[model samples]
Target: MTFAFPRAVLEQHTAFLGKTGSGKTSTAKLAVEQILAANPAARVCVLDPIKSDWWGMTSSADGQRPGLPFYILGGPRGHVALHDSAGKAIGELVATGDLPLSIIDMADFNAGGLQKFFNDFAPALMKRMRGVVYLVIEEAHEFAPKERAGIGAENLAIHNAKKLATAGRSKGIRLMVVTQRTQALHNAVLGSCDTMIAHRLTAPADQDPVKKWLKSNVDKMTFERVSSSLASLKTGSGWLCSGEAQVADLVQFPKISTFDNSATPTDGDAELHVQTAPVDRDRLRAIIGDAVKLAEENDVPRLRAEIIRLNAELASSGASQTVAAPQEEIDAAYQEGLWTGCIPSWTCSRT
Candidate 1:
């Protein structure tokens, strides 16, 4: 059965909890797609540690909507460094309305890098938000673990995330946290959510938190029935519970309208084909101009240093010794829908 959420309800904090292979990502994607479809001005930021799971949001195949902007902070295709400046640049990009939907692939970063990026990005994003923004965190437990110890960076990240969960709503930053292991997530973050879309979960560790949270809203008999139903749910089927029973239901998601780029890769599917389209020159120019402007306005020393280093490298290589023709040429080429030189902090591919 299909379930639709109003804009008001969509803006509230939500959680997607289930075991692996239980369709948490797919359901979350569908919810995001619908949110964007219903509100053209809405913005979404996905923290995808898997790097490839959210590509469908940027895929423009037969049934998919036009692709969204893509940013790779630390992944196989990453171009942006994991420095604080780069993190802030991304936050500024989002805060300044430069990106509509941004998927940050974090698969390549080490634990330390991941923690630093998250700690830096959340505050920057909250600082300049002018409109409502949805922040989707996949593998939520990694960012906000239940147990704290010698992991300083992770603990810092968790602290920042908890702050966002508790206080970000006034700033128009909402969260959609996806996790396979509910027991491992920080209680503060989980407790902040008023809506939960839960799929099959048999582990007592996982079930207990859900039951504990629902007990206050659902009667004992209904809770038992819902608990049993949750344990036996098939893939793509789950219970959608809001703060109370009157607004909840069992939902069965239909086939997603976009390409499943996140599908598990098998031996036979090793060499898949992806469609590409011509880049939009005006959009590319606007993005570049905004990024440069934000970098200057934010006084990001690392970005400035990186730019200087790149210019020096170009000069020393004699490719643009006279007047740094490499960057100039790159800009000219991009204006003509061609990409040259190394990847920038953010890159857009048409498909």
Candidate 2:
């Protein structure tokens, strides 16, 4: 069955869980494609441990027109210095709407380096952008583990991830975490997700968390039925559960128009060669410069004042000022000049 995700849910937290070869990555990419396709102004940043998977989006294998202009950071030969000012500048550029869809491939770095990179970049990006940006973390279990005992820099990375998980929504930084091991993932990160898309999962470790999360809306009998049916789920099929939708259902994802660069390589397959392109730094700077000019022309100070007033009203009512209000109210506010031009429409109202 077709499952339609609301715009509110798209701008919130989402998780995709499944075993290897169960289509977790594909499903996550499908969600990203859907979001960007539905909203041209929307942007996404993918953190891929393997650099090759998302290259298809940058350029087609068959030499056709590319899907999106992706600026990639780090690769097989070397990594971007994430802790340095140059690295922070990249984050700032993205935060300021310079890069539309950026990919940070961690294949070049070891565990320690990857941890440092996340610790440095996550907060920087959060500080720069308010919202309308989607950060997709592939293999999330490695970055935010349930037990961060002795990984050195990884501990700090986990802390940074947890902080972002809890507070990033208010700033419009939405996370889409994809992982094969559900139990190994950090509890804080999983608990923060508003939506869960689960594929075939047979192991009790993985099934337990999904079962527990689903228990809120699904009865024991119905849950058992659904659990039993999960074994029969094929690739690209799963259940979509979220508070935004009234009922969860077994759903099959539609085929993506772009190439699946993340496809698993088969034995005896010929070696594939592809060239990596550098990011257009000049163009990115110009984009950010134009954005700043637009904000100035739109009277950002007045917009900020209106946002502060709205936030105070929400807080006095004992509701989260960061959470969106109802869509109707936001629409009315926009008409009445109560809405701010800076905030995203999705976060304008609680859905």
Candidate 3:
């Protein structure tokens, strides 16, 4: 049965973590596409670091009723190129900076070359956001590892994302961080999400994080065994956890029908071949431009700066920034901090 998302928490942000060939990317793409198709005003931004199979749609930016878009970054020849709807080359953006600091708030931490993209590109795109802005990230551990517990850009990003997950719902920003190793993700990232999608991860160690993240709501052994059993689930079959076990169930995607029937060769009737059109470059550029424009109008830079400063401050407190606190308490602390800024000397410390 299909599950419905709560309107109050309508901005759906999901984390699909699974090993290679587990179909996390394909599943995310399907869900986002469905969201866009259902809502004409909807838009999405994807941070594709590896330029995986999803790159095929990069050239079709100009077509489709609500055209889909794509942008290609790392590939052979060591240069980043932006393609348009017609598969035509447009221009290239510099690929430089520390990788860790690229996407999150680094505060001069280990932010490799990716810093250039996040600081230069991401801010611009987030501004023009319209209906919904979903962030689809794979290999998330590279940015947010479990072992290192300190202040960094990756940590900052996680912090800000969690904040957004809790409060950005009304602001129209949604995030979906996909990874094969669930344990590697920060608790803040997982905690912010209302829904968690698990694929065929067979290890108990990997599933341990979810157990801790979900608390007594889910048992470690049961989740591990359930996820491990996914090998038998038809290609697209998987489960959705929304805090209630009675609602979650295995689901399968319908076979994709293409315009050119001849293009699809006859195969085993059981295995449906779903064709995801190549990434659309022109559309991507347009979406990025639109998102950037929205962010600009809504003071995205200022908001990000606020988040950056708050993150840095929290990092200095000598406590885990991902520490789970009640919403009321968090708001109280924020209020106290604001009041402290107004009142010259009295600072309230966490009790």
- Which residue segments of model 2 deviate by more than 4 Å? 1-4, 60-63, 76-87, 264-351
Better of 2 and 3 by TM-score: 2
lDDT score of model 3?
0.46
Off by over 4 Å in 3: 1-10, 58-67, 71-111, 119-131, 149-166, 213-235, 244-246, 255-351
lDDT of 1 by residue, 23-104 (tens): 9998888888788778767888888865457765555544234454444333443323233235666777777777666777
Full ranking by TM-score: 1, 2, 3
Off by over 4 Å in 1: 6-8, 60-74, 77-85, 264-272, 276-351
Instruction: Indicate the TM-score of model 3.
Output: 0.53
Candidate achieving higher TM-score, 1 or 2 = 1
> What does candidate 2's lDDT look like per residue over 163-218, in tens digits?
87998888878999998989999988988988888898878888888888878756
- The model with the greatest TM-score is 1
Query: On residues 55-163, what C-alpha lDDT tens digit does candidate 3 reach at each position?
Result: 3232222222222433333332111332111111111121111111011211221134332344334433334334445566556665456655453355445544455
TM, every model: 0.75, 0.72, 0.53
